[model samples]
Target: MLHSIRAIVNGSTNFILTKMFDENLGFKEALLLAQQLGFAESNPTLDVEGFDALNKWTIFLCHAYGIVTTPDQILFTGIQNIHKSDALVAKARGQQIRLVAQAKKLVDGGVAAFVLPQFVLADNPLSFVKNEYNGVVIESGFADQQFFYGKGAGSFPTASAVLSDLSALRYGYKYEYKKLYHHEPNQLNDDIYLRVYVSFTDVKNIPTEDFEWIEQWHAQEDRKYLSGVIALKKLKTTIWWKENGTSLILEPDPIIENIEVRKLKKKAWNWLDYCRINLI
Candidate 1:
């Protein structure tokens, strides 16, 4: 890995090759190589979950705070569990879901590491990132705040970042170093969007009162489906319920579990069907 890092730093060198013998050729290979080559001194977990953003955050912590922390000490989350329903819900609320990984220095000489889904507000810098784009923000007393935005992952991007590190190392840039201290977890609160679908036949048996509730929460029309419009509300209520093979759609008043979200979708479908029949 050091050789690879060195090659990247050289800049003049092109076509660096890395070979992995492991059966799972995913991020484990990269993580292992990084550790073996001293780029990282300990095992990292998020590397396997495709959350390399956390790894990058650690590197930033090292540079900014002069601290070295184990991967386990960082709180990591992944987007593997995000469902289509969630995305749809976000769209209904005039928002989008982003996989955000962040680290920050606390007041007590510690750092915070975490990764999860975030609903970027229109004015937030991260809201501009689309597709696979990535962004980073750093704040400190001297620098006030700094922002780094670019491709967070991909072979070429990784290579570029490695190359930059190599150039700095080769130039004999002296960096101030500080030991890592255990820090409290970051208190994260971000909205999420979910998209749900229900069979047309299963949306006719829910109660009228439930349908009224859904109508009140309705936000906008959805272009993807003909039967339903996009709806928005807080993520805290049980807006959907299922009954007698019918499903209903409704918006939650506050944040709820994904399972509850599923159940709500089922109920919403049922409610829609009931309205269709009564109108007919």
Candidate 2:
């Protein structure tokens, strides 16, 4: 009903991640099976790395807001770099690591959109969607939450969509663009602050001054979790942890407050499951 929509527009990566998390399969194994089962292409460069989703996002924008853009114009990240350790970390916290592609209207009359990897809490309906399925959430004034979940991959599915398009043509029907003027997509961290879980092998390489505050952290010899709230703009430019094999997931909410590093242990559950108040 609303002009704005948020959707997970990919199927191969969804299926692979589903297999990796729900079925407990490795990335390689899940990818191989996806290709074998016709869920993925022989050369799955687009699907696995998120280019496919980027394309779908571009299409969505064209129809939803009458804005047309290219893949290079948007912020995009894929699931190719997701490691088993990352999945295990999310699983330990009762979360699902999902490669979510999101597009929505911002409060400032601009659009905030991106396709990237994010951690979904167990309570979210998106976490329950698995395999070659897609979950799309449309939020607006009249319709607060509209979720569309179904099989979104395979040759049959693709053909069915193609046929539907053809059938619409027979009826002299076409998608109408509600918006033709385009504005620059808002960069992350501009006006919105997100709670991110950043993991790295070494803490020395992290930039401590960029975040407004460090809520909590978990330190391990080879793995660490730095939980903090930061602007989306600052986060893109301050990815120093990647050189040290760092991975990040945006939290759904900011729960923890100012936490001291001394209280962090080598292994602890989420910020909620661990000690909220630092005793030391």
Candidate 3:
């Protein structure tokens, strides 16, 4: 649909995450299983590294909103860093991890897109999208929410898609590109903020000072987890998140409002104030 807000289009990463979440398999183990089952490739860099989803998101951008963008132009992260511990924590919290490629039309007529592993709440439809199934949830202002799901990978789906394309061509079908020709495409915006979860072996690897807000945190003997709000721009520009065995994932419904950002910043400041006074 023309007003589609978000689309999760990749199945390889989804299958891996599904295995990790449902079967408690580690990343590499799940990946190997996927490769064995034809869900993934011998070289899974494109799928597990988020490039495949990034490319698919760009195509969705062009088709849905007439916005032309490349994978390099957007911020993306993959499931490679996900560990069994992360999956355990998520399962304990009744959430599932999924690689989601989503874009939203902002109030300022700009668009923001990301391909990243996200925590899906139990009630979210994405939580049920397991194995090699792909699911897309499109939120439209006028039509409410619509969801589509199907096999997104493997030889059968690929062959079916090719045959469908041939059939469409034989029937003289064509994409109107109405959004591109008749409507003004929105520009990609990186000025927004997202609530994120980061698990790391060392706090030094995390840029805590850059956080607009931190809602929760925990430290165990082996690992530490922090939940915070950060600028999308910072994520795009910084390399800290990719280093030293750090894993970052977005919370379910990661986007937050500017007013909420300000309020959380104030709360974080108050928390620091209490910490400074030893009032805990």
Give the number of the best model, judged by TM-score.
Answer: 3
lDDT, candidate 1, 1-280, per-residue tens: 0000000111000000111111222234444554554343364434323246556656655644445665555544433333344445556666544545554433333343444344444555555554334555555566655566654444576679799989999998765543234332223222222232222232233323422123243324432211222222222233232223222222222223333556676787788789899976
- List the lowest-lDDT window of 10 residues for candidate 3: 1-10
Worst ten-residue run, lDDT, model 2?
Answer: 254-263
Q: Which ten residues in a row have the lowest lDDT in candidate 1?
A: 1-10
Instruction: Give each model's whole-structure lDDT.
Output: 0.39, 0.72, 0.85
Query: Each model's number of backbone clashes?
Result: 33, 5, 0
Off by over 4 Å in 3: 1-4, 166-174, 278-280
User: Candidate 1 — what's its lDDT?
Assistant: 0.39
Candidate that scores best on lDDT: 3
- lDDT, candidate 2, residue 138? 80
TM-score of 3: 0.93
Ranking by TM-score: 3, 2, 1
> Of the candidates numbered 1 and 3, which has the greater lDDT value?
3
TM-score of each: 0.42, 0.77, 0.93
